[model samples]
Target: MPKWRIGYRTLKTAIGAALSIFIAQLLQLDFYVSAGIITVLCISVTKKESVRASWERILACLVGLIYGSIVYELIGYHPISIALLFLLFIPTAVAIGAKRGVVTSVVIMLHLYTIEGVNVEVLINEILLIIIGVGVALIMNMYMPSNEKDLTWKQVRLEDCFRSIWKEFASYLRFGDNSWDGKEIADAAAFIEEGKEMALKNVDNHFLRNDDYFYHYFKMREKQFAVIKSILPFISTLDRTLIQGEKMASFMEELSQAVSPGNTSAYFLVRLNELRNELQQMELPQTREEFEVRSSLFYILHELEEYLLTKKKFKPDPKRTKTVSAKRLNRDHEQRDTK
Candidate 1:
């Protein structure tokens, strides 16, 4: 859900509580008693930890009430003495950290000492009202529970990683630029790490309902990531070869077309398999010369073949050109233009 909607719901619940208290006051009920009930009900209906909060509030108020009664009996009826008694519980209230508990305790103590009736009837009413508030809170919470469910953390992490992989592969296919954006790669890597962590969290050490789907998705994603990771350095080499007037234009044209789904060459899968195998053994080239020489049309063909075979091994067509001479013609045209 949108954050704004969540905020609005919280606001609405608080307003509803205030309105309920107002209505209760109009019916000649004690405002403090009504306010306590409204507060508990509001928290119960709107908050994530409503039941726990209500329980804590009830416990804190009970403690405060006991403390207040003890102080009232010991300190007698001096205004200053009652005030001091109330002040003594402030530290305990602060420790408990319940707004309702502190307010209710202070109000009840003030009413007990200052009000004309210093009997057990007032204390009983106060306790009964607090109990009613808690009961109302529990009843409301049972009827309107929080709208959240337990999700398998492992499945979620795996799904996230798979989505990242899909995006990365799609981006690479569209751009023909093998170089991955560091940020995007980092995000995908993080998701993969999170998935690993979630995998460790499994008690039964088994796949859940969505786990199999995620596993298949993860495998596809890993394959795509590997292809891009291998091809990035070779892409720069191909560009350099074009700059050096290398005549592999037809070969590149065939490879580029094969990379596209429509009009894909019959030998495309075979060539991709060869490419994949070569990449598995290939070391990272430190020099530009190594990059260019090691990633020539012949090497690329082998790498492409291996890549395809990893998915599925297939036959290569003999008619496919290993190299093309269009770059030579392009270089001649450039020379003529320079002259």
Candidate 2:
């Protein structure tokens, strides 16, 4: 099922329980009496939360059962007694599930207090009911499972990373042409940081899940990130390269085309491999000028290389020429309108 439908189901479950309990109380029926049934219904039906979240909720309810039992037995039969019991149990529950800590605890306590007086029998019954509810929920979830297995969060992260690199690459091209947008540079830096965090999260998830394909994808992601990191510092240097202006123009044009989603040439990859070899063989630059020239060239080349590698891995269909042609025509039209 779609993610939004899952979310809707979760919302419906929560609301249904709340509504059930409200109606029960309006009819002067025992609130706690209906709470367990509502809880079971909610747990069984909700589809948004992960299995891990469901497990946590079940554990928290079990803990709440013990706490509720203790309060019923130790405290006297007074409203103050139940209220004080709640004060104690709520914090403990919160500690267990910090995100929904207070809410979960309140649900448990309300279920207990809504009944006349807490006693050993009531405690045992409440505990059994909660366990039954959780069990039923787990069974239902197994049969009608959410599409958690199909979620490719790592792929999403990689896509974002590629987009950031593309933006930075675009900026480099503009800067080389002496019409650089300063805003693009700042935006690119922000996107780079966001992409870095996403990459780290993707790596962590891959390691935790022990996913081989995702792990390989993460390595590829790291290589791409490294290429971008190596080039960012050199973008300003390209602005000052008087002698290599023509060379820079040619290189930028090639890089831009490779990233344009229109060009099919694998020339960027070839140029990038050559640049990497040059960087490896050339002596370390001592002065700022030398560093700028070398670093700028390396950055542009590395970015182009990454784009080419990604494209080669996920090639577009040649039959989609019409799409590319249309995009080019639209771009030309926009440029003419601006002029």
Please give each candidate's TM-score: 0.43, 0.52
lDDT of each: 0.48, 0.52
What TM-score number comes out for model 1?
0.43
lDDT of 2 by residue, 232-265 (tens): 5565566443434344455555554444333444
Per-prediction CA RMSD (Å): 15.4, 8.5
Residue-level error in angstroms, candidate 2, position 277 = 5.6
Q: What is the lDDT of candidate 1?
A: 0.48
Report the number of the highest-TM-score candidate. Answer: 2
Error of 2 at 47 (Å): 4.6
Highest lDDT, which number? 2
Question: Cα deviation in Å at residue 238, candidate 1?
Answer: 11
TM-score of 2: 0.52
Instruction: Give candidate 2's total backbone clashes.
Output: 1
